[model samples]
Target: MVWNWQQTDWPEFRYDSAALASLEETFLLRAGELFGAFHHVNPNDRDTLRIELISDEALKTSEIEGEILNRDSVQSSLRQQMGLDSETRRILPEERGIAEMMVTLYRTYGDSLTHYGLFSWHKMVMAGHRDIQIVGGYREHDDPMQVVSGPIGREKVHFEAPPSNQIRAEMDAFIEWFNGSAPDGKSPRPALLRSGIAHLYFESIHPFEDGNGRIGRALSEKALAQNLGQPTLIALAYTIERNRKTYYEILERSNKSNEITNWLVYFAETILEAQANTLTRIEFYIAKARLYDRLRGKLNPRQKKALARMFREGVEGFKGGLSAENYIRITGASRATTTRDLQDLVDKGALTRTGERRHTRYWLANTQTDQSPIERRGV
Candidate 1:
């Protein structure tokens, strides 16, 4: 029988600080840099970036659990929560539920984590879903909860959670520690390390019959926000999704081992990656702002809409840039008008034309000039 963390001395999760010292320093430094960059963004761009970041986090968290949500609906739900205009005309209950939970977690970053709070969050996340079998509060039965992989009849048990009876006491202890621990106090554990431990511990407890993974990730984000003294836009789930296989393997390995140094290291590295990715997005937003300023009076509404789409899609924005037909479809313009618009953009140097005749397409010109904000910062 594999001994889980609960079978150990409990509450005391020990690891060598010297082992993770370098990583801890690196993560903290990067997190500081990301936060500093965020502070420099103008109010308009900051709000836009916040919307994008939260939407990505909510969508990716659900996607990790094999639940694919419509991105537009999620965006609309988040927009409504943020008091912005929603693009989607209709919102699904699932989208609204996830968005509500995300906004709550973000806005209430300083609040104490409680049993009732977790129950409410679970209820909100599971609200209006007809197919889920688990109740919102907690597991009521004594059935063993196991995580398994492989074929249905020949499943390989990866890990078994503590029996249902242990959940109440275990959760209470978790809540207490989470509420009390501070990164800067006399007995200090780095916030990133606490985030990793909290995540693994919550998942191991398996308090809910379902949605454990999503909730566990959300708890980690909450811990990070508390440490920073503000809400963070770092999307850890996006990084985790890219490293999904390694994520599960490390969790199982740590659960079975006496030392969780490896898990801590992995968690630190993931935070670094997430912060770096977020920095890139911030840079992109800065670039977008500069581009908009440059073309403020040069481009028409259709051109501006098309350019916005290109910026949003990044490298994935239409393989060879957007063609005339594509522009027409997006802007609801007739062919003749679309042609004139495209030519106008090319003439104004906002876009560069490629190929000829029906094969012609337009790509955003190099918008960063010598004096642009992104260029000034050497980005």
Candidate 2:
């Protein structure tokens, strides 16, 4: 079956009152919940800190370009690109582009909304997957770009070429609107909605030779933080990856019908799902942190210092879970001193011994309760 490659008409996308109302209601409720989760500081229940940590983990996880571009390889390469450790690897020019893209996003946060910001994004998208057959280069040549897995897959395209000039102009217009929209006296577009719209439009434009999907997703974050002032905590990529087939289908459906309502709904629902998943992870981590805090009294000064270092740096052994080696490094003590502290900690029940000998590690003791054996032992 041949699928039609139709152009989008911006004028047709009017907000449906009922849909808008429903969206508003949902966002309001979500916003309130998010605010509480992020801002409410409970010393005994440090859920907000966990939420922050989980969000960072999600960002690192989602930054990788998986199977849509070799999932496993992309992740492995991306970690190298992050430049966090000392390891070095040779990168293809295209892969370098992806690396640069990850760096820009991670470092800049929401500031990547300016003209320069958009260009950097486009440059990386083009660089990352310039050789892919689906769409390559700014101009369409003798080879018609194939749209696989759609009603139009394997069909020869015989339509007016996408107007590059018009695309450039429309993109600029959107940027202009976005940069100054808050001051323009127009009722604010919801940040979540704006992110959805930006994704839909960028995909509709499909400007790059390849890697448009990843670039669009990256830009969606920019629109969220810049246009909406909210950093996206959910993994949109994770959700889309899970439903890759439906993802394309929904995007195609929106294009064919020029109806954004369904796309908006899908995008919003994915975000909500992602947020809910994040909430669960945060709660679990918070519980772990609370358990660690409760066990602090059982720890001596050196053990407490070791535990704090583990929490601050997230070292392998000290991640709310302590170990003898961690105690040695954290306290800057000799092996004998560290060993004595570890044993004392175990006796006080501030740490529990697991495994055996040098293989043994200490963990927060009695994580479920605030009681400490140190106080009981009068240590």
Candidate 3:
């Protein structure tokens, strides 16, 4: 079966720009919203936002590859790379690798994509591995790089990358296209279009032996960031990982030919969804900042500790939702104190409770995604 790169017109992707124009416009509009919200984030707080969002994308990107790195380790590594932390501490190789790549991507996204830059990213991704015929360089193995699944006898090949000898030329052209197709390049494209195409193009080549998906996603993130003139806050990998099965299906389908309008639409919608999710996170942070202001000196030490712990879990609000036992565990309070603290939290609007008696669960009350308090007042 012919793949996209095997086509006579391989890599000359075709799509209806009109079909994606609306999505492109909406993307810009939402980006404006995000920029405005982020603008209000206190400079110090924006650093925290950067660390959290970048760490989340790093974690989710790795999760997509079926490799789960410790989230705390990822964040800690990011803190160090981003210069937010300076206390030298031991970090696992696996954790430090992706964090370093992400931090580097965020810092140098505007720089042109080159062989050395990509090699650097590949080495960062395959940090601790002792195996693999090639780590930071293109695969020179004789066996075809086939993506497959199923048991030994019934293995089904999902896709196979171009042969090793073809990689250098393919990557050279891809890097050229990536740089030349940017928003301000000689052949400029819209934000989402450039990002979507870059991702599809890079994935079709599957240039590296491993971490191609992660690096491809990173390339797309760079593409998006280049358009906006800043590092993107959108959780592209996190959003894609939610519907991973469908993501693979669409990608597989798109790889068969270069007329990739469907793929572009799918990817743009994913970016839009990611953008919204990011906005919610920013608004949640805004709400957290406001809540802290509201709660100053109003709560006991236990409540303060509990609230801080809950907020640490971010907008998701402590896994499985916060419970009285959870609060007690967090604050080391007795049953009576736990009940009182929970009730007091609910009363003060710091948290909202659901269920009753033994089943009671709580979440930060102000984290309404529909609107932030500042927005609701029409500020």
Candidate 4:
């Protein structure tokens, strides 16, 4: 069927109340409270957290594009694309841009009562890599209907429109509504709902020749900040990457219907998941913090500094231990001071030594597990 682009008006779509209700149920007051805590973390700490989350999200999204989706491979792709000069390993470039953008979004939210500038959000993502084209902004070229992949193993489908020069105009209108008119002047919708809608609207527009999905997702987070009063702490990108097919299918079905209920519902559910995961991480951090605190009375300043650094950078090698040399570099302490600190930590039962003599290193006294016993206490 030849679809007429000019004939497609967003108002023709209907909102599904049932779907919206289901979506709202997912983000009860408790979820919001948890998300608020996640938002209060330091921006640098948040950036560090996102480095892991976005790396996983980008990998998962790539897998949706039919590439192998895993932590290591995705990390490799990110390293080269981002030009992160590493002393030992590669870092993903997208993570850098995403982290930087989120910080800007968060800072902007604090300063303005209404932080819904599409250009500002767009500029944040564009700052690092304009050459990437960001996937979903208005197209300057042929402006053909954008197609994304279908159900796994199925052929891709395009959002086709009858050939017309007004393709650009159609795209522009979507952006204008998306960035400007969608939120009424009075009580704006909650950030989560607005973000969900922004995701839907931008995808429906299919504005860019490429990178629409990535940019659309980014816009969703920006909307979340404006509506929710906090930028995201959860890894919603990872959630979408995990349920890529369901995500697209919901969008497709909802786009054909009136009120974007299904799409919004799905986005809400994912937000809940992302928020929950973030809470889980926060619990771990608190637990870890307490554990570190418990040792503070037992540790000297040097030992405490070294341990703090270890927690931040993560333990290295399969042994999951640090050497005297590594401690010296991390603490910027003298070799004798590093040795004394390591020995003191070992004496205090905060760390344990592994290997013999020259090959020896120190590891956290506790064993590593996905969810530490301390973490279960919620710190």
Candidate 5:
């Protein structure tokens, strides 16, 4: 028989604090470093990073549920949410809806979470999917809801949510606990731990007919933001999406076992990894910004556009540095023009070239060194 939270001493999750003690300290320290670094950056850089992070979160969270959304559309949606122009593209309803939900999580990170708030989020998630029979609220029927995989007949149910009748009571208790444990509430809980628990608890309940996974992750994001007293640049969903199999396995294990220590440990470690990744990205952003500053007004329009594309693509900017062919593709320049641009960049010392003929590639001259910004900062 599969064990569920409802049967395991309802509303009181047991976890070993000692098990998470060291991890919690490390996470808090790293989180502080990330937030501190973010604070020191210019407002433009900050906005750029926020757009990238939020866009990644929206995309990855949906990807976790096996839903693929257009990356450009999502970024456009996030730009609109930030009150910026949509860069010559009309906002798709789907993009607008998901962006609205993500913005709400960030904007109201510190607000008292309520059932109505969650309901609104659900509505946003389903805004563009009119064909789906499921509505934007709690399921009315009590049919068993299980996450399954494999062929239709040979499907395997990973886990089951609480019965429909139990959703209201379960959600009520969850909302009360969540609000009561806010930083200023009567029984304040550690923000990190509370986020992990909230995620697990919400998924276990599976209140809405659809979009539970996304909403649960959004809630986790909000919890982390609230804990940090500001919006976090880290996207936990990116890490989760990468380790999706392990994510599901841990959730299943936590649901089946009475002791949630293992789950907490896993969740904390995931957060640690997410924070570390965010720090590395921030360092990259700073490095790229500094590089642009140095190269400002030194390169022609084609060279500048090619360099900007390389920064946007990051590690995968090119298989090697960047080939003339790749430059042409990115900048829509003629072969002759592309070659001239590449040579101009090399001449200006903004890019370094290597290899012979088609094998030749170019890399940011200043970034030829292997050290990242974090290392340079001596962190």
Candidate 6:
């Protein structure tokens, strides 16, 4: 099947901008409100949000390509690269490379998408790998660059990119299109539209021997961030990873034509979903800090320790909710003391207990609270 890259109107994408109004509205609604709420988030928590977004993007983008990175190492590598707390621990090479690429994307969102920039990103993404024939540059081998699946003799060719001989020229055109379509460029497109097209355009070229998917996602993030005037910090890759099957399906279909309304709508919806989830996470952080402030100096040491453990599980707030037995395991308190401390935490507005008797389970109070301004604004 012929791809868009081989069409007569190649690189001259066409779509009805009017159709994106609903998506653009939702996009604006979430982005405008969420960022305003960000101003109210504590500086420390905001840093946490930034790290989580970057590290999560790094990890999920890799996982989409079947590379499972160590979450702890990825986070640590991100913190170190971001210069947070001057993190000095050794980072595994896989984690370090993706973390570096993510941080570069975050820091350089406003910069022009250049060949050098892409090459640097490619080098970082390909770090720790010794066998790639074209590290840090476009593939030079004459072999076809094909996206395929299944066994050696029974493979399915999903899509094939442009010839390797044409990569440099294709990439030059892609870079020009990318920068020229920017918010500040000659023909500025809407944020989601530009982002969607940018990602599609980059992926169709598939310039690198490895790491094209990761870099394409980065370009999309940069496009969003550049238009919005800050790093979006949305769980874009995370959301896409969860819907990876649909992502590939839509991408494959969109590759067949330049009329990409379906692709844009799908991507826009994905962005909106990602932004909403990010808002929930941010609200949780704000509520968490506020709860900590409210409970300060009011809890016994065991209660404080136990509550902290519960919160360490993040927005989901401990698996299956925290149980008294779980509390005893965490705090080493007697069953009697664990029961009392858990009860006291509930009474002090520090937790919300659900179930009863042997079925009893508890949750961090902030998760249940309807009081956070962040949550209120998020709606």
Top candidate by TM-score: 3
Model 6 scores a C-alpha lDDT of 0.85
Residue 191, model 1: Cα distance from true site in angstroms: 1.4
Please write out the lDDT profile of model 4 over residues 27-140, one tens digit for every residue: 556467666665665554654455555565554444554544346544444443444424445434444444444445445643432223444445444443556443334445
Candidate achieving the largest lDDT: 3
lDDT of 2 by residue, 1-379 (tens): 2222353455245444455455546555765566465554475444235334423433343344342243333434555555433445455555455556755675565552565676566676556443554332343344444344435556533222235545556566656655543323254566667667778776666665556677778766666555435554544565566566666667776665455777777776665655554454444445556656667556667777765554443212354355566666678889899888878777766567778876787775543322111111100
Model 5 residue 354 CA deviation (Å) reads 5.0
RMSD of every candidate to native, in Å, equals 5.1, 11.0, 4.4, 9.1, 4.0, 3.9
Candidate 5, 141-241: lDDT as tens digits = 76787878899899988888888888888888999988887787788878678888888888888888789999998888788777778887686998889
Model 3 steric clash pairs: none
For 1-379, candidate 6 gives per-residue lDDT tens digits of: 8899999999888887877887787788889877987778887677777887677788899999999998778888888777785767777777899999998888889999889999999988988888789888999888899999999999999999999999999999998989998988998988999999999999999999999999999999999999998888888998899889989988998899998888888888788878877777778778878988898889888887887777667666687988888988888999988888888888988888899899999887756423232111101
* Rank order (by TM-score, best first): 3, 6, 5, 1, 4, 2
Worst 10 residues of 6 by lDDT: 370-379
The residue-by-residue lDDT of candidate 1 on 323-357, one tens digit each, is 98889888999999998998888887777888988
Assess each prediction's global lDDT (C-alpha) against the native. 0.78, 0.55, 0.88, 0.56, 0.79, 0.85
User: In terms of TM-score, how similar is model 4 to the real structure?
Assistant: 0.58
Question: In model 3, where do residues sit more than 4 Å from their true spots?
Answer: 371-379
Model 2 regions more than 4 Å off: 1-8, 39-103, 106-115, 125-146, 150-166, 180-187, 291-379
Kindly report which residue stretches of model 5 are placed more than 4 angstroms away from their true locations once superposed. 86-88, 319-321, 334-337, 347-349, 352-357, 365-379
Better of 4 and 5 by TM-score: 5
- Provide TM-scores for the models: 0.85, 0.58, 0.94, 0.58, 0.90, 0.90
lDDT (Cα, tens digit) per residue for candidate 3, span 172-281: 99999998988767898899999999999999988888889999999999999899999877889988898899789889888889999888988888888888889988
Candidate 2: pairs in clash: 3-152, 66-71, 67-71, 135-209
